[model samples]
Target: MLLLINVLLASWFYTAHGQGKPCDYPVIKHGWLYYSYRGYFPAHVNQQFVYSCDRYFVPPSQRSWDHLTCTAQGWSPEEPCLRQCIFNYLENGHNPHREEKYLQGETVRVRCYEGYSLQNDQNTMTCTESGWSPPPRCTLVKTCSKSEIRIENGFLSESAFTYPLNKQTEYKCKPGYVTADGKTSGLITCLQDGWSAQPVCIKSCDRPVFEKARVKSDDTWFRLNDRLDYECLDGYETREGRTTDSIVCGQDGWSNKAACYERECSIPQMDTYLNAYPRKDTFKVGDVLKFSCSQGRIMVGADSVQCYHFGWSPKLPTCKVGKVKACAPPPQLLNGKGKEIHKEEYAHNEVVEYVCNPRFLMKGSHKIQCVDGRWTALPVCIEEERTCGNIPDLDHGDIKPSVPPYHHGDSVEFSCREAFTMIGPRFITCISGEWTQPPQCIATDELKKCKGSTLFPPVGKPAHMIEYDHNTNKSYRCRGKSEHKHSICINGEWDPKVDCKEEAQIQTCPPPPQIPNAQDMTTTVKYQDGGKNINSM
Candidate 1:
């Protein structure tokens, strides 16, 4: 009975093993499979096995070891582990063979995009344990070389032998030469093809010699298109019938001839009762002429006149009737008494004297004389009276001629002490028994308000306001700009830090057409292709 029971169990085990299909062994490259301790041959359904990668290699999950399951079809993970060197994406480069994972020690040819180059002119990348060796990066390529440059009468200021694209260098010309823009020194930039500008020096012009003219310049050298102004000397004029003219310097020489000629004056028109000697249609400069009155008339002005560059000098004399009578008694002097006042009738050229009363000042000459049939102008005396008391004292200031009581019509000047500002008029006068308003000497520190003025550009029009207090704000729009600018008053000043500038006009463009694989275009777009780089002027 025991032998029969053992046979039946063996049959049952064989039948169950035959019914279920088993999975083939997994052959993973660069990896090893770990078997269970039970040593089951031919993996069965629902069976799980552990696999590990070689040194520097990992599974798809980036782990050293991972489990694989056996399903009814086959092993869940067909390939367990692989070499883990991933492909390095180059920012400005292209790879011929792109893959998700690159095997260790594998190399691929690469090239940089336009206007870029790899360091050391290398063109290959190798996969290594750490990653891609010699990291795939491209730098901007240099386009200009110093050896190919040739400057005539000029030299570069920098010491560099090679320059990258868009690099700038300063150049200076010789003493007697200048750049195209009339400057002795200029800048040049390295561009895609070559240098931005030619380093050639142009000839400069020297100061010109003038005849009968003069200029007020100390400089001996001038650049092309430079203008020089000159004024003709006395009694000289230019061909343009003017005294002043300008000459421009050209590439070869000065534009116009700078010279002046002697001047001539036309003859004078004489009065009906006068005769002029040596009369002519025109007179040369510095010529003189003599005049005489008619036989029965006496001269009333100068008898001679001289011709000048502009016209004649010392007007011609005039003829007048002669007097043949005696003079009357001397006229009375106001606020004074006359001396030597003798007879009622006196001969021509007789003199009389006058004196003023006490506390009265004398005006005009103290003596008068008889001329022709009339007496000369009489002297007058003005009362010297003090109307204002002692000048009012001032704080931080003093008045000149402090001695007072001040007389009527007298004035005093006021000056502030050092570091102080004076407000209102600087002078005060005594008028009609009263003094004018006096100015105040306010300290500079106390003047914290800004006087309203149009000196600042932020103030659009001339301001008539008295003053602006501290911390006041003002707003105005600049010319051609819609946005308003602001200014503030600080410590007695309207400080508009920014200057009013004309608004820059931006060119508008139509919307760009839709691109197949690009983002929407806004104001600008950065696009690159395999072509030469260009620069804007």
Candidate 2:
């Protein structure tokens, strides 16, 4: 029975070639191996065999390679592997599917090791005839991207840069801030998928509620540096310790307590070198407190104060004498003059106004006020030297300006009116108060001077009429013996016509020189030969 089975298998392999004819070898798809271990297949048309990659390169595919068979229709669903890719790597390149060679169209994958990452990563390589383009190159570890990773209100302990895989990176909230869970710091391990979670640094609040006063701006949420403005209603003011008007927003909440109470004020007094009039110990709200400095002390602040809903309108003035610094005469300015001064020595708070001459514009500060005996600033008088004269009108076009009478170093542009075109410069500049070369506006399509007859060969027109500053060509055939093949018009000039001459016509064949054994004959297909001849013998 075993001998019979072997004979039958050998016969099947040769049967398809021609009813038991044999072949030198069994047929299989090129670049694929025939796995005869299961059973042998015949090498005739339509014969098939199971195949695999034996010594060939391994593929990254998870599925099995195809089993190929011979078919009359060129191996049903033919797959060819003509070109294979060869990739080379220097020491330390880590491709998961490293191999000496790869079949064309095969793909190989790789990943960076634990702590390193890929720079300009080309980790996935595809095999091509030229080679594996850009073999997988990766740094030895993992890293986090600052641009790709963001932690709200928190910053990384490491410089915003790459780190090794599994390396722990810490995050910290800025001062006066903490995490949403009230933690001030956190850590995330660098991973292939990036940091696991981003740290959220929310505003820390010991208490959010207020007593005896409602929140301002109707704000329900708060953050660092945010402000809250308060208003006291019904002629009442905030409590003595409570701040009204505007309170600064701090990490902990408002910087001060807030409360509403009836308005009241006490007589205000300066701490030094100052006193209030009427010598009252206390005064009611809305009363005015006039202040004067002691002798030899110059008043440097509000001369008087009114006790308003908020409190004294202005803080009490101070007295000082020797700390004052002086400034020399103000810098001289063209086309400007300063007002006269009464005192020989200019004192703090004294102001001098400057006036510019007619047609001149003031540029800098208009007044030089003395500050601590030093002048605040001197005014500058800038002359309007940028006046450009009226731009001349164009005959067939009008001119427009970005502004009027274009200034010096400024330009005025002109455009052709309807159906007109400019013949020269389209814009003119104001150089030294004068306009530069201006272009003339001419009727559109009329400036081109090509004669119609010369361009058309006494026949058809170009696709369109010839015009100035245009290029166009027209096909033409001469009406007479010599013909023009093409005519082109450019910039109002027509190129010289290309003359075509008809090939000379021969009416008849000349006397045939006699060959020793041949004779000449004539035949005509037109008009019974009409005595016109072509040699035909």
Please tell me which predicted candidate would have the highest TM-score against the true structure: 1
List ranges where model 2 is wrong by over 4 Å.
1-44, 47-70, 80-106, 114-122, 127-133, 139-161, 164-175, 178-208, 220-227, 232-237, 241-246, 250-253, 261-537
Q: Which candidate is the best by lDDT?
A: 1
Query: What TM-score would every model get versus the actual structure?
Result: 0.30, 0.27
Worst 10 residues of 1 by lDDT: 519-528
Per-residue alpha-carbon lDDT of model 1 for 448-488, expressed as tens digits?
88776453344454565657776678776666777777888
- Candidate 1: the clashing residue pairs are none
TM-score of 1: 0.30
Computed on alpha carbons, the lDDT of every model, listed in order, comes to 0.70, 0.57
